[model samples]
Target chain A: MNTSSTFPSGEIQRIKGCCISLPGNDIDTDRIIPARFLKCVNFEALGEQVFADDRKELNGFHPFDIPINKGAKILIVNDNFGCGSSREHAPQALMRWGIRGIIGQSFAEIFYGNCLALGIPCATIERRESDELVESVRNKPLTEWDFDLNKLEVSNNNISFKLSIDKGSLGMLINGSWDATSQLISQGEKIDKTIAKLPYLNDFF
Target chain B: MSKNTLYDKVWDLHQVGQLPGGSTQLFIGLHLIHEVTSPQAFAALKEKDLSVRCPERTIATVDHIVPTNNQQRPFADPLAEEMLRTLEMNCSKNGIKFHGIGTGQQGIVHVIAPELGLTQPGMTIACGDSHTSTHGAFGAIAFGIGTSQVRDVLASQSLSINKLKVRRIWVEGELAKGVYAKDLILHIIRTLGVKGGVGYAYEFGGPAIKLLSMEERMTICNMAIEGGARCGYINPDQVTYEYLKGRSHAPTNDAWNKAIKWWKSLCSDEKSIFDDQVNFNATEIAPTVTWGITPAQAIGIDESVPESSSLPKNEKAITEEAYSYMGLKAGQEISGLAIDVCFIGSCTNGRISDLQTAAEIVKGKRVAKGIKAFVVPGSEQVAKAAIHDGLDVIFKQAGFEWREPGCSMCLAMNPDRLEGRQISASSSNRNFKGRQGSASGRTLLMSPAMVAAAAIQGKVTDVRTFFKTNSDQSSKTL
Candidate 1:
């Protein structure tokens, strides 16, 4: 799917891809990638297992199993997407399955942060707009969508909808600053200073 | 925009610097790692040629994949064994302290930290597990992080995180005899929707909170992630100091007194401002049970499932999905719904007190004929304590299997799991679809005592009906 096995990296200012809609609120990480799949030491084998249970339950009737939805890179979802379990496996599985971006009514804080760390943009829109987008995608499976972080909107040739992401996250996504380890490591002096000043670390002396 | 709150004070203290992308480089005072989420992070460190900045501050434990029944070397499942071994190797290689199986200290990361007093006030904690919020009960600013952020913390002892607004959740009045902290938190989640705390940290305060024990407070904060809050806390007080006074990692001698003074100072100021505030009457919260997939889809034990037409338009989709998946009809009473399994364990409600309370309910009663019931201690220390108190004996005599500690049945990553469409009365934090192993397995989340009561009757019966207060001990008959 998508013919690209390379992991996402660098600035992610825009994501243009055919969209797939997954409707339902509070679709937790367990449903995304079941706990049984997390037994692996590495995340390499998780792609094929994304929504493994849900897909199996639906028996090819699920949106992800539909032939037309194959190779879709953008995921459209409802409220509180990725609501439970801080397991980054959920987004890692989705990303491995070719989802470069997610548009949802809202996202859990940890899930949103996990997506950002992997360079996946999670943009939010109003419930009405999300419903309309899901409807549009269902009416015309595999509708191409252009999601622009700079413009804070998602659009096709005929229709457009505004999107919202925290300004800090937006800036990081566009500037490739989402990979936060290097930046944090660069502030070595500041971290040392903070640690030295902590009361608990010093035994309260 | 909250001011003078414990969150603000802790965030300001832990602020290492400002990052280029407008996020704060916040120093992590404590970094916790577990088998499930830390392997990739450790591997990332190797890939980047980086090392753990503060090895002493980071702790590791094996929980998620450890089998409760047979925790012998080279576990029955090779994958699970490999994960645990990888974690052991990672901890040893990185010079990080690890609490592995048979260590007596090993248990669920969230449960072990507080019991050992590694969790403290005015500290910032981060773990890859979502229930790391459990540390917030000690007045720490603890939250869950993804593995990438875990790598950041390992490499730098800090994270580039955006600050969160603080919401004060005030609950007045004391809880009734049968209602526990689990019920109160479930009620809170039901009242505020799961995503209500998406962008805010919750400050649980008020008289009702003050009345809870340290373990009970941990129970409330452990499920903060389930309520969509990255962190939840109650300011440290006399109760907090008392709990940490004699633990292994707590301060000694004069330092203990000094720590108390500083911890007390970290409480939210009387004049502190909050981004949002909500209030609930603790007495109003009954023994709550989840009827749907989400933690928010809960109702009092006496209430019935709401009809789809009665719900808001936005809720109809998930509600319908829940009704169909759970095999429950609309307007069905939750009380008499049969349960095939009863599990009492997790970072949420697997503490010593949770076990003691549940044991009290099933002390003389046998589990319903066909029901498979068990109790899993959250950690080894919890199991030890429970055994010391003879709670494990009570549990076993009541037809419940008393298993070893480590997140058993909570995520069902271990061998313990549900079969087919079996519905379980669980004290775990989540009730998500497929959360308990089987794709079609069902879970009804409640307090440990409620789960015990369900085991006795093989249904979702209210714990209140079976619970007898100390004053009514002479008439203690289920």
Candidate 2:
């Protein structure tokens, strides 16, 4: 499926790639794409700076700097990934860095919404399940894993486990209904009618 | 029929319709924009050949990267100047009102709105900045959105979002003398883990919240996002109504009573059911500060940084990471830690009252030698008011640089930043690593008054000590 297609036709049913695991929990947006990098007028080229400071501090020992993880397409994170700041650059940086999907115990609400907008499906598994999956992925580095949206499952051929996602978000991922702007535009007449009835808005318009 | 929660009342009133994916198409009553986040959003609109759906409903300002020292054209930082120019051009092209530098109306997007009476009760507000929840103090349902969502709002004047469960956070009793609203919020984030409010809208009420000024309430709701809430609000009351009265955008004369009546109705019903409930005693809260990266990793002024081994299982790893990143020893007392800088401004605490409180502490004192301290008001209005009341004189007398109104040193988008390994006593929200510009910089979040006390001592001295000294000196003079 072409997850990158704009509005209406694109849908993502599955993500297949070797995963790179970042074991930290509460990995906030500032860490994902630090505040200083947010100064740009546009989000392009942000991939080069994703975790820029952290990578530098880790002295090339970080997972993202490791040669084996260079082309990794999936990211396995711990609980509450993307927890602070409403900056869209966090997800933009990740996608630009070639990460196609994320699996974690949980995600910040706004971050979850942003990923859906960009067609990045974020699935959740129980803590124990996520821990085991991450361990397996680490043990057999570069082994391809499949995360199937329709079945809500992740597998590495030998081991498999079910995951969870809100039904609405799952439907949007499967059918490509995450193009909320298109839906919003389609209902333009209704919105106009509603705005006309708002007392405060009447003065402005 | 289900009794409506505050979230439901606001959500139902503003919802346009439910989309195919079950997300509601919510109309945005107010859309706030700033230079850092809006340029790309406007560029996205240009990419699609779309105009702003309703320019009249939008307000633009330059805050994030605007230098606070000199109010001049062609800033020394070319990128900052370029960003401001792009925002100005976009606002002019779209016919949206731009509160540029020296405009008097210009300030932090979150600060200027409420000060101008543009933020009101029962409104659904959206902004590109995360602290947009600051508007929730007036009983509005406000939240931060991404650039993509900002583009969506600019094109359609609406947003598609799923409904959130309501959590009532009941804070009771009275705050101690030196403990302020910033302390209260830090305490809340400390109790509820960083992600505790996921999928929730926190309804802050009870005697303690009701007693707080509108500015104080704003400080509380301002950092609600730090606790992972989608948004946070307090029901409108006499305090809320009084603050909105006689403002530029608020209704006047005959329309005033009608507006109040409608706002009054927006409050959650006494017997309304919440998805979850939590209570905190105001008396139990103390002057608070963060020692770790996440806002939840906070302790009272008299408390110590938690030992990783002593932390709960889920908190151990982050605690260890924070310890290493901060270069702080576990179990070390938060007090008496040397600080290199002190900042008193942000959407979180850069209000008139906050400055006034801090000024009272610094009135007859001077900043400790070798400490870099400064105060930036939330807006031009706040600066003008502070100047009129001699708060500027007090801050200046104490050696704090009185700068122009903008989000200076809050996130370090401007020239104000912590140089390598410099630790700061800041009034801004969030202590995340590198949040204040330098990769190795450290931040200790606190109230503005606490920041003043720290500036005087060059360390995390308790504000209560200053309070006692001030009173004793007053008695001697009298």
**Tens digits of lDDT, candidate 2, B240-346:** 99999999989987678878877877789877889888999999888998998889989999999988887789988889988988889998999999999999999
Q: What DockQ score does model 2 reach against the true complex? A: 0.59
Against the true structure, whose DockQ is highest?
Answer: 1
DockQ of each: 0.86, 0.59
TM-score of chain B of 2: 0.98
TM-score of chain A of each: 0.96, 0.92
Residues forming the 10-long window of minimal summed lDDT in candidate 2 chain B:
B1-10
lDDT of 1 by residue, A65-170 (tens): 9888888888999889998888999999998888999999999999999999999999999988887888888788767889999999989998999999998898
True contacts kept of 1: 0.85
Residue-level error in angstroms, candidate 1, position A51: 0.3
Model 1 bad stretches (over 4 Å): A2-5, B468-478
Shift of residue B376 alpha carbon in model 2, Å? 1.2
Each prediction's fraction of true contacts recovered: 0.85, 0.58
Instruction: For candidate 1, give the DockQ.
Output: 0.86
